[model samples]
Target: MGGTDCGAYRAGLGVYAIGRLAGAEAAELFAHLRGCPPCRAELAELRRVAELLAHCVPAREGAGRGPRTGASRTGLSGACAYGSRGPGRSR
Candidate 1:
């Protein structure tokens, strides 16, 4: 599926990662990833991003108190820049 192009490979990265790619296409991409440094780096980056996204849980606040737990977005950084500005802030 046109994986020779960096953009095209990136477009299919999420699909491949989530196990939604068709068998033939998945196999092809797997082969491509092995010898492609850029693709391998991107796949690693996507995995990192996916793991970060999975931790996105809504916080529960109590009356006149702090959050119920330590679950937070602090220190998270990416294209969204979730927590890279400053302390207790995001940009």
Candidate 2:
């Protein structure tokens, strides 16, 4: 199992994250994930992005429809989502 091809295992991640992989296959992928930090991180980020995508509203039907210029949903003009960074704010 340790020598299995990474591409095949990586391909399973999307299905596995959603609990759609068959039981034995899921277990196999889990074993691979346990030993592979890069793969594990990729899977984690994929899951997070999936959650973010789920909350996204559909685009309005118009030529100019787009996310408002630079504002995140957080309403902070240029501030990062978390908060201001003192001196860094002057940069």
Question: Which structure among the candidates has the greatest lDDT?
Answer: 2
Model 2, TM vs. native: 0.53
Every model's Cα RMSD, please? Answer: 11.0, 10.8
What TM-score fits each model?
A: 0.51, 0.53
lDDT of 1 by residue, 1-91 (tens): 2346666567888877656788887887888887789888888888788777658745456643644334324533353443446455754
Q: For model 1, how big is the CA root-mean-square deviation? A: 11.0
Clashing pairs for predicted structure model 1, backbone only: none
lDDT assessment of candidate 1: 0.68
Q: How many clashes does the backbone of model 1 have?
A: 0
Lowest summed lDDT window (length 10), candidate 2: 81-90
lDDT of 2 by residue, 1-91 (tens): 3666789788888877666789888998898988888788888987887778658856557844555645554565645543477434555
